[model samples]
Target: MTSPGMSITQLLPDGKLIVLCGRADDASAWQDLLGPARCLAIALDDAPHEARPRTLRGASDHLAWQHHAIGGLDGSGWLAEPADAFDPDHTATLVLPDPLDPPDAGNRRRFGFRRPAWRLFEDKTMVDTLWDAAGVPRAPSIVGDGTADLSVLGAIVDQGTGVVCSCQPRGAGPSAGGDGIWWWREGPPPTTIPTAGPGTWRVRLMPLLEGVPVRLHGLALTTRIIPFPPMELVTLPRPGQGTFLCAGAVPLLDDAADLVTHTERIGVGLRERLGYRGGFSVDGILTPSGFQPTDFNARLTSAMEAAPSDRRVLLHAVNLLAREGNEPDTGAVEQLAEDLFTIGTSCTIFGAATHADDRASRTTSVRWDGDRLVPAPSGAADGRLLITPSPRGWLLTATLATARLPGGGRVGPRAPEIFRVSDEVLGTNFGHLVPPFDTRPSACLPKVALNPEPATR
Candidate 1:
């Protein structure tokens, strides 16, 4: 039975169109999220907000799911009916809320793709300014003006300390280099830190052992450690508490309750600070000290859909779409969430492909192939979860589960996972097509860190 106080409006599918934005959340994830219920999945042709349908997958194919476009609408409540409204060729009209609408703006700011807080939060130099104010734990950080000596970076880490480097524009878009690097005293000597075309990049500092590689991801106040290199120190905040880790690497969050609480706090705090209208994620490190944030993602992140079943992360999706500013009742939400978690009905996020195309970028599938996350090849016919990049980055709108990782890691925090597929390989063997890519971009995303590199998921 649905939880009491759970309004029908909360579960309303009426006029609710679930849209797939990019190669993320292909088909399978869509089916898993929307269930066998009838739905349509449409692909948009443009980037950012210039959304136009390049292809359409119908619901009958088991490949198709419900999708629509919320193009060019501000925060007001004024709705813009497409010029081709009722076009004979089209089956439905495009609907959007006004940007000026209070609830609409609030909702948009809360869940929209552009999250500004992540920028201010992840700046290592900003440590003294914002960390304590946000209720985040404090740690030793080495800051740079982007022009300091790399060896000094090593000194800052001293003996047993980790390093965090923030690289800024060194040259042009693809040519710009780094701002500076951060590390702890225990890490190895500073190696070449790749610079990206001046966008925004942040790194987490931790003790690095000999031959350990550092290929981290995330921007500004949120960064995650790449698990390819084993880590010894990890910290996690108590569940629902205000403190959190900012990095993306999950290996550090070994405790479930701690992860849930800190994650909730980080999620709620970020939404409030950034005026972001979409998804944002904060990565963390579980050190002996506690869960400390390493970095932040202002847009839809890989973690958005990874929560275990009983968590019903779909509620997050629903809440993201609801009127903003009005915080949901924490007590009531906790009660309902507990019920969902107890039933083992959590949500997993996935990505989709255009035409079973192997060129799909980003992590799309999560199944255990002897304990690692090996992404299932994506394509329209494959029925994998679908996701798309908007002006804000990647958006996750679907979900699924694949073979469990070996050992007893538990696929997504627990066993008996949801929507298990037969591992019927789909799409072309594009694994080669997706190069782990130079995350740093300036150094051509730089070759995978020498020692411990990212293990393919």
Candidate 2:
């Protein structure tokens, strides 16, 4: 009768609070969403003075962290077991990371520090089982170790279907920068995708799935070809085009609610089966029949940005936060989201040591131009977007309502097709920074590499 109780609330010892970011948690966006609570920016790694004490970016709001977490800064600081910081109770709502991992019986969930769960939400077998049980439409698939004989792959190819290379028992690539492409097996591959492997030679297979040539598809929460490192990996469709930056949830673009409902069911099934209490993401394909489950990430996926749109998901998450005693108002969260879609409000909150450097508190430019989300320029060596606010100590960022999605959404003409814009181009090339700023002695900037052109050799 009460809609399964997806939302919760909590009270922290100090006035401090922690709110899980189900959607884009960029500083510019959070400034408005959780305005009542004193804001604390959590960074996974070390940052400039203002962005210090870099906590697990969103780990404070995870379910596992509720019991043991702490908060400070007069409602600004939080130290907890992650999930509990947002919702003390496990009523609903889940936290997932990026670059998910495949599910295994040996997998165990950890909290607080950056446990493996702190990464992406990936659960391959779980997804397959759920879809198979639910009768969701999907591509044919074959699952085995990296060195299994493949009859299914060949059968699928014989039918003229291209194979989506799936690396079973997921492994790391050449490095963090490599693409993580996988797929389920099906007869013949799709024509829209370019050829894969050297000379685009598709591999043939012996019978891995009933002597039937099945095309292979894979689940990839994180890929190598990502435009920028870290936080910017989540993809956004270009304007007008309806697609997901991450995997799964593509088939129900017209009906995100239904898609989310099915997704939640799968999540519940997985949690029950695996004792999985962290981040888990499901990757599937959209076929003529319906949505097919491609794989499961026993971990987290970047798709979390979509959670804010789902009422059930948000409510459950809040309940979990409530158990931890740092209940952020559900009404406020909803109002903030509505504002973003309507009037378009933006914000940036900084957290740094009391005394830092000149670079600690200054942002080069912040402007709201014709729906185009842009950041001004800074002369710092890193030429990074994270600039120090004026008067030092505090990192400053401007939030504004724009005509288009900012930080992590679609860009360019069709701006709805999934793609990530080079921030350097937006900040420096397009000169979208906030100004009346400092152009003084520069600090050592991180050396960023350049992306090659698509046609280059």
Query: What lDDT would each prediction earn against the true structure?
Result: 0.32, 0.29
Minimal lDDT window, size 10, model 1: 433-442
Decoy 2 TM-score against native:
0.37
TM-score of each: 0.43, 0.37
Q: How many backbone collisions does model 1 have?
A: 127
Please name the candidate that would achieve the greatest TM-score relative to the true structure: 1
Task: Give the per-residue lDDT digits (tens) of candidate 2, residues 181-296.
Answer: 32223433333233333322222222211110101111111111101011111122211221112211211102233334444444444444433343344443323233344444
lDDT (C-alpha) at residue 286 in model 1:
38
Give lDDT tens digits, candidate 1, residues 1-457.
Answer: 5542344224434433333333334333433554434333332223233333334321111111111233332322112222223122333322221110111211221222222344444344453345455566645555544434545654555444334444433221111011243232333433445443223443333332222112122111222111111111111111122111111122211224334444445444443454333334444333333545544433333332244432333434433443233333444443543443331232332322233434544334444454233445553221234444432223333343222224422222221121113111233111211111111111211111111222121
How does candidate 1 score on lDDT? 0.32
Indicate the TM-score of model 1: 0.43
